[model samples]
Target: MAFTCTIPAVATLQQDDEAIRITRWDFEPGAVTGWHSHGWPYFVVMLVDGTLRIHDGEKATDVPLVQGQAYMRQAGIQHDVMNGSPHPIAFIEIEVKQPAALKQLAA
Candidate 1:
């Protein structure tokens, strides 16, 4: 089932290239990102100290966030994200689209 929301968060594309795509997301309390999946592995750096409510297909999980802290997830992750905090929340998402050759070169 596709996740839908009444109010969605703001997602700004900061950068997009062959190897990566970066987005800055801002959300008011109760705002959602809707249901989605990433084609590449991604990392997220939380911009504020707050909690995010994530629906991971089966259940909803409220996760705590710390400013400047980062977390990563593999590709094909599907979920809906919501700002559970009373205050506004922001974060930077980095999607790695590195090709096999590029990944080998970096290794």
Candidate 2:
């Protein structure tokens, strides 16, 4: 079954520029960000210790997160992020923009 949020996750735009886009997500119990894909590489900084369920279409994985923990994911990851905990959880997402020079260097 596809995951749907009864109450959508709250996203606060922290910054948006040519370099990157920063957003803070607040998820209440059973809240979900819905199915989506990242266009660019991004990093996540956990603001609270809680359990999050990440569904990558085929399966769902429960990830235990701790406050201040951070991780990075490459572009094109399609998934739904859900708050699996009973309490509220939050995280900061920073999307990395590849500058023209950086893209060329990677080639």
Candidate 3:
């Protein structure tokens, strides 16, 4: 298993329709999300923003995360995350519903 940033929610519903789940993730400098997959295609919108260093197992790069910006990711893309800021980092993760069969793929 790999290390991943913790998901924090002080309150609310864990699941619902639209098959979409939104989450607020915060990370400090050197923070990282272990290699993992969403199991579904989804969108990501940066909220309390910062920069992130993304690792795709094969390569790594830095992506600037700014407020009000959104990015779409392929379902089950195994990648790692890292905080590139000295301060805390935060963002909104929107998960979309995907069929179970398609979720099980080799990364």
lDDT winner among the candidates? Answer: 2
Clashing pairs in 1: none
Off by over 4 Å in 3: 1-18, 98-107
Q: Which candidate, 1 or 3, would have the higher TM-score against the true structure?
A: 1
Give the per-residue lDDT digits (tens) of candidate 2, residues 23-90: 99999999999889899899999999989899888888999999999999999999998999999999
Worst ten in a row by lDDT for model 1 = 98-107
Model 2 — which ten-residue stretch has the worst lDDT?
98-107
lDDT of 3 by residue, 33-80 (tens): 667777878777777668878877776788887888898988868877
Ranking by lDDT: 2, 1, 3
Mind giving the per-residue lDDT tens digits that candidate 1 earns over 1-107? Answer: 43455588999999999888899999999899999888999999998898989998888899998999999999999999989899999999999898552544444
Q: Give every collision pair in model 2.
A: none
Q: Clashing pairs in model 3?
A: 3-34, 4-34
**For every model shown, what is its TM-score relative to the native structure?**
0.88, 0.88, 0.72
* Overall lDDT per candidate, in order of appearance: 0.88, 0.89, 0.70
Model 2: CA > 4 A from native: 99-107
